[model samples]
Target: MSAEQTQASGVVGVLESVGRKSLGLFEEIGRFFFILHATVYWTFRRPFDGKEWLRQMVRVGVDSLPVVGLTSMFTGMVLALQTYRGFERFHAEGFVASVVSLSLTRELAPVLASLMIAGRVGSSLAAELGTMRVTEQIDALYAMATEPIQYLVVPRVGATTVMLPPLVAIANGLGIFGGYAISVALMGANPVTYWEKTFQYLDLNDVSSGLIKAAVFGLILSVTGCSKGFFTTGGAEGVGRATTSAVVMGSVVILVSDFFLTKILF
Candidate 1:
């Protein structure tokens, strides 16, 4: 074959490969939505498992409180310290509380809380379900005439979705307190001024927005984690891979969706 023809063929091969990958990505997205739909549908169907749902709530929400609290606390403190430095240059150090409060309520609290949950809860769900898949427990459920989506995914996704708003609320309050501790107790900023400024710029909408974002993030992480776990293959290695993928994908989805959520909420 002529060299020109060979080069053209190579270019065509590259295009084909790109097209195939794009198609595969769309196919995966479609599958994810299908699973999400199935899980949601089965969640409200007859024979509801309130006990399992509560169990998942404790696992995903209650167990996640400590890590989320610590993360929000430290984050608020650091945010206050950093913003103070910048505001001090303009003789506006009093605005540090306002900045920290706004930042935490509008963005940091939800994003950080979600990321922590994704790391902790998402990985755990994926690993647990992956183990079940590898051990044939999922298939066993089918053998017993149980739908895995209804039995496993629905409770987890529903519980996480239900619990994340409250968690985010707690994180937001703690984050504000962290800022207050730094600004008033440590930095010697006026306590009344700090507290007053913190509330001055904040309203109900700001707090509600963060909670809304948290709920959405919870759904994303839970669905992604459960999906990864349900589809796991291979063996122990596959479980490990699913766990890692759950965390990575959950985090990515949270970060990406935050922009759009913010825009819409704003």
Candidate 2:
């Protein structure tokens, strides 16, 4: 073939590839929404499985407490250390408590806790559902006259959404306490001044905003994880891939939406 013809063909091929990818992405998005819709609709249906929901909540929230706690506490400590160093130059050491408390409740606790949950609980959701998919257990649900979305997805979605707010609340408190500890014990700040400053600038609005963000993040993570797993194909490899995608996609959605949530809330 002529060089010009070959180059033209290459350009057409590239365009075709891009078009296919774009279409696939949109198709996946459609499926994701479908699952989300079905999950939400079935959530209010009769025969509410409190047993399964409580079980999943334990798995998603209680099981993940240590990871979330450590992450939030360290995040608070790091913020305190950095802010103390910087604020010391300006003779604003007292304000370190304010910064730490406000930042944790307003931003760090929810975001960090959600990301950690996505890594731990989200991955498990994807892996568990993906395995059921590949093993044909999901299909078996249909054979048994069960709505998979109701039996499987709703529990996870509900558990995640309901549990995340409380998790963020606890994380915020622990994170603030962490900041206070570091600022007072290590930095030699006045404990009374630090404790007083912590609440001086913080308000209910900041804590409420983070809790709202956490709930939304929980919805996003659970939906993404369930979507990725529910439609998983292949076998063992597909389970692993879905699990990875669940974590990555959930984290990305949480982070990107955080900016918008913060803007709207704060």
RMSD (Cα, Å) for all candidates, in order, is 1.4, 0.9
Estimate, for each residue in 44-92, the C-alpha lDDT of model 1 and write its tens digit: 8878999999999998889999999999999999999999888889999
- Per-residue error at 201 for model 1, in Å? 1.0
**What is the alpha-carbon RMSD of candidate 2 to the true structure?**
0.9
Off by over 4 Å in 2: none
Q: Tens digit of lDDT per residue, candidate 2, span 1-266?
A: 69999999999999999999999889878978998999989999987999999999999889888889889998899999999999999998889999999999999999999999899888988999999999999999989989999999999999999999999998998898889889888999999988999999888999999999999999999999999999999999999999999999899889999999989998
**The candidate that achieves the highest TM-score relative to the unseen native structure:** 2
lDDT of each: 0.92, 0.92
TM-score to native of every candidate shown = 0.95, 0.98
TM-score, prediction 2: 0.98
Off by over 4 Å in 1: none
